[model samples]
Structures are given as C-alpha cells and as structure tokens.
Target: MKISIITVCYNSDATLEKTILSVGGQTYKNIEHIIVDGLSSDNTVKIIQKHQDKIAHWISEPDKGLYDAMNKGIEMATGDIVGILNSDDTFFSKAVLSEIALFHTKNTIDASVGNIIQHKADGKVVRAYSSKYWKPEKLKIGFMPPHPSIFFRRTLFNTLGFYELGFIIGADYELITRFFLKANISWKYSGITTTAMLVGGLSSSGSSSYQLITTEIQKALTMNGLYFSPFKIKMRFAWKIIGFLKK
Candidate 1:
C-alpha cells in the first residue's frame, strides 16, 4: 500500500527537520512524503529543500491555518492511504510505516489508529494517549482517537468529507467523530505507538484553547445530531488522567 504522509508547518524550522527525517527513515519504501508550509519566514523552507529528494512533493505558501495547509496536502496526495504528521511530531520508530503496511495487507480496513506519547520541549515525557476506549457510540461521552496517530484511506475523505476549515482546534476531532458516529466507517486499531508528540498542542493546553475545544466539540456533536454536554468535559479530563496513569 502506498501511504502518503503529509506534514504541515509555518516557521517551524527548529522542529520540522525531525518530522521530515522520521518520514524519510520509514522502512516502508512505498511511502510518499508531502510537505505544505505556510510561507515560513525562517529556514524551514531551506531545510525542506535540503531533504527535497526524499520528499515526493512540497510547497511553501501562505495559508489560512494548520487545517488549510492539511487540505492542500490532501489535494496533492495520490497515495491509497493518507496520514497527517504534525511538524512538531515524529513517527515513534523506523518500523512504524512498515507495520502499518503489514496491517493493511492483512486486514481490509478503511482506516487504522495507534497510540502517541506526548512530551515537553525539554524531551520529558508528559503523557501517553490511546484509542483503546473509543467506540462510535462513545462520541457522545467524550471519547476520540489521537489524530496524529491515525491513518485513513484517501477515499475516506471523499466518502465522508475533509476537515472543516473554521474550527481552530477541533477539526480533527470533528472529522473523526463524523467518521465513526455519523458516517459509520470501520477502522483497525493497533497497540503500537505510531508517533511521539510534544504536549501543549492546540487541543491539549491553555485555557483559551480548551474553551475553543469545548465550543467546537459542542458544535461538531450537535451539528451531526449527536449528543453534546459541557458537563462531560470534566469526564474527558478524567479519562485523560487514566491514559496518563496507564502509561
């Protein structure tokens, strides 16, 4: 299976190289790396160009935001499977892509999800996240998979829809909720860690970001005819604590 891994960045020179190199180091050779940059003013584009040979396609231009650039990468992707890797994240090991390929070759799945470990900029592991508790019916109860560790068939976008643009942080959440709860797409789950990310990302920290997440989750669930309750936000944190403890 040809998997297209997309990385989107903006002025992320310090952290982008590790992400690019992680994709380049994948043991699965059928992989294609597509990078979309938001006209980075620093050395990000130069670093991208340095490793351009390993990249299947890349472009640097002004974009609306992270999701917008992701949409652009989706448009450029030609592989059978599409996965987004954040600029600040990397596949956990060189074998990750190969493992994904093996899984797809054996199972007829529309999507696959794994796990992620989050850390601080200082490289201290903060917490680990997983989708083991996720079920389509649990969408109303504040359960969802880690976005960076999930891979979807390219056609899944056509069948369901692309990430909605207006959401500041919950677009990935909205997309997966729509896929599992509304569109009824089946997925395979792997216990292996696909990516290691730094914590305090858009949906992970800050009071403002949390507020935006709550509002967007509400909008996403309600608009899709699923139940939404602000009260469940605390339960979400409790579930996260369990994830941390399990790690």
Candidate 2:
C-alpha cells in the first residue's frame, strides 16, 4: 500500500533537514512526501528547495497555522494511507514505514499506532511515552495515541472528516478521541517504537501544556458522551500535575 507522509513546518530550517532525511531514507519505496510550509522567513524554503527533487509535492506559502497546514497536506495526499510527521520529529528508523505496510497487510485495521520517544533540543532522549493497549476505559481518563505515531487509512477522513480547525492546541487530541472512542473503529497497537519527538513541542511542555491537556480531556469526555463531575475534572487536573512533576 502506498503511504503519504506529510510534514508541516514554519521557520524550522534548523530541524527540517533531519525530518526530510528521515522520510527520504524510508525502506518503503511507494511512499509520497508532502510538505506544507508556512512561508518561513528563515532558510526553511531554501532547505526545502534543496531537497525538492526527492519530495513529491511541497508548497511554501503563508497558512492560517499548524492545523491549517496539516489540512492542506491532507488535501494534497494521494496515497492509500496517510500519516503526519512534524518538522521537529523523525521516524524511529528507516524500516518504520515498511513495518507499517506489513502490519496493515496482515490485519484489517483502520488505524495503527506505536510508541514515541521525547528528545531534547540538544538531541538527548528524555523519556518514552508508550500508548496503552486500546481500551474504552483508558480513553475516558485522557489516554490517547500520539499523533506522530499514528498511521491511518485515508478513508477515515472521508468518513469522519479531518482535524477540526477550531482547535489550536488540542485538535489532534480531539481527532483521536472522535476516531477511537466515539466511532469505535478497528485500530491496532503496533507495540513498537515509531517516532522520536522533540520534548518542547506545543502539547508536550511549557506553560501552555496544562491548558492544552485540560481542554483535551474535557473535549474528549464531552465528545464521547461521558459526563465529568467537578470531582472528576479535578482528578484529571491532578493527573496532569503528576505528569508534569514526572517530566
């Protein structure tokens, strides 16, 4: 099956090359690389032009934001399966795509996800966030598969629609909840490493991370028809605090 991998970027010249090389080095040959750049002022456009021949389709134009760029990439995608890899992230290994293809061929799954390792800006591995084996109860407590580690059949979008542009920080979380929890799609856990993500990503760290988490959990519960009492909301906030402490 052909896979279309989308990389969204802004002023990311410093880290874009790593993501480019990672996608270019994939063992699966029937793969298409699509890039949507937000008209960066840095050398990001130059870097993209340097590797233009290897990339299938790319556009360096101003966009609304991250989710808008991703939506554009989804529209441009022509592969049987679709996945997104952020500019600051890379595949865990060259065989990652090949393994994904093999897994899809063996099982009938609408989506497949794996583990992700968070790395520092200096290229230091911080911690590994492993996805829980898929379960409805776990999802109620704010469990979700990392977006970078997920590969889903493109038809999922045709059925359920793309990420909601309304969400700035929690759209991915909302999308995953809609697909896995609400729709009850056939998804599989690869139980293997998939992507290495930078630690300081929007939803991973910093002051805004708390807001993102709370919004995501609230949205997830609401969308799934699960009512969260005041106590439950506080419990979820406490969990976020514990997670930040561990980080």
Q: Which regions of candidate 2 deviate over 4 angstroms?
A: 237-247
What is candidate 1's TM-score against the reference? 0.94
Index of the highest-TM-score prediction: 1
The digit string of per-residue lDDT tens for model 2 on 69-170 reads: 998998999998899999989999999999999998998999988888988888799888777554545556666677788898998898898887777677
Estimate, for each residue in 164-227, the C-alpha lDDT of model 1 and write its tens digit.
9978888888898888788888787877689999786777668777677877888888778886
Per-prediction tally of clashes: 0, 0
List clashing residue pairs in candidate 2: none
lDDT of candidate 2 at residue 2, scale 0 to 100 = 92
* Displacement of the residue 208 alpha carbon in candidate 1, Å: 2.1
Model 1, which residues run further than 4 Å from truth?
239-247
TM per candidate comes to 0.94, 0.91
Q: Candidate 2: lDDT over CA atoms?
A: 0.84
Clashing pairs in 1: none
